[model samples]
Target: MSEGNGPTEGQDKVQSSAPPNAVWPLRDKEGNVTVPFAYGTIAFWQGKRAQEYQTHKWHVYVRGANNEDLTPLIERVIFQLHPSFNNPTRVIDTAPFHVCELGWGEFEITIRIFFHDGPEQGLEIKHMLKLFPRVGEPSQKKPVVSERHDEFVFNAPNEGLLQRIGMCNTRMPNGGPAWATIEPFFSPLNEHEELLRIQAAQRRVQAEITLVKEELENEEQILSFLQDEVKKLEPSIVKKPPGT
Candidate 1:
């Protein structure tokens, strides 16, 4: 009843001989002209014989009685005959029984049944068929910056920084009284680098402004000196003084 599970029980086996009022033709291993049987629902052969029903492979089919239609009862029979209904790998396919050949008085119905290995094998077969399509396909690549850098340093606040600085000092050479005398230039080197850039930019701007102001002052001083000389020369060039 569940998916992929075959019949559970009550599957009747084909008989060796034919039943009453049934007719069936017998064929050789190659399906050549053989013999015909009368009055039998099922037929059988001695030793090993090859019979093909549904699958390409040939199997032996033994005849049985029960002249009634076997198609309707097939489901019940398979369910009874198969091992377990819960097996994960088993799959069954069934078809309506049909009359292959007509005999004297008896009739025979041919049933086709098939069983598949499992889903995994079927999937593997499919993948094998698709290998050429998957070949030469490009794989995804990740950016270099996606990975974290181990050398990147993280700095803490003043109190924590001082603690770490003190710890480093304890391991220094001639560490006793030198600590008080030597100024601990906690060169927040990392911080200092940033501060250095900011200070450099500020100094450049200030220098530019100072140069512009000095140029303007120099120009004003030169203009005043020129005006004073021009005024003193104007009196000398004028016509006779008061004594004249």
Candidate 2:
């Protein structure tokens, strides 16, 4: 898949009645719950003299967009680290969900997110850890930041989940959830802001496609003109046959 075109975000739907053993709240009119989130790593390079294996310190985290607390919607997060590490599997069950360590090598980290309600299956995701700067980019003291934005869609959600989602989206001073009172690293996503970002990316890709098409058309025109000129000269360029 192209960049920003990875797997679809998590979508949980309830199709049939719950099992006899399980009890869930009545379905709400909202019908769908969307929780926007971002996951990736932030890494800082140690000085050149540091050990090769410990040249970079990094933290891998899954956070609600703009650093909003995810405790309301997420029950816990399971992170599978590289096998080289001792006890490679780690579980976090609170806000500021993250793991911190020192390492130089890069690898793909597996993350599984469990929701607070039913749908026993957890959403699985993979992220590639990057520590070094790309070619042609200047190196600096600032940490390298790489993250992807996505949202979870819960369809036909029960009343309990709808209430939790409501708490997450509501603003403070209006009986919002406790987490809303906390400060975020960045401004919260405004209405339609996610749509606007997607549209902007699409526009950039479309512009590049248009330029390529124009170049192809120009080359085709040049080829056609050369073929016509060659046809015009053929008669004179061809010597008459001896019999003719």
The candidate that wins on lDDT is: 2
* Candidate 1 Cα errors over 4 Å, as ranges: 1-190, 237-244
- Residue 63 of candidate 1: its Cα lDDT? 13
Model 1 quality (TM-score): 0.20
In model 2, which runs have C-alpha deviations exceeding 4 angstroms? 1-31, 136-140, 169-193, 196-244
What TM-score does candidate 2 reach? 0.60
lDDT of each: 0.26, 0.64
The numbered model that scores best in TM-score is 2
Q: Give per-model TM-scores.
A: 0.20, 0.60
Cα lDDT tens digits for candidate 1, 1-244: 1122222233233331212322322223553322111111111111123222211111111111212222221221111111222432322323112111111111112222321211111211000001011244322221001000011111221443333322221111221221111112111123345457768989999999999999999999999999999998997795877887
Q: Supply candidate 2's per-residue lDDT for 163.
A: 68
The alpha-carbon lDDT assigned to residue 190 of candidate 1 equals 39
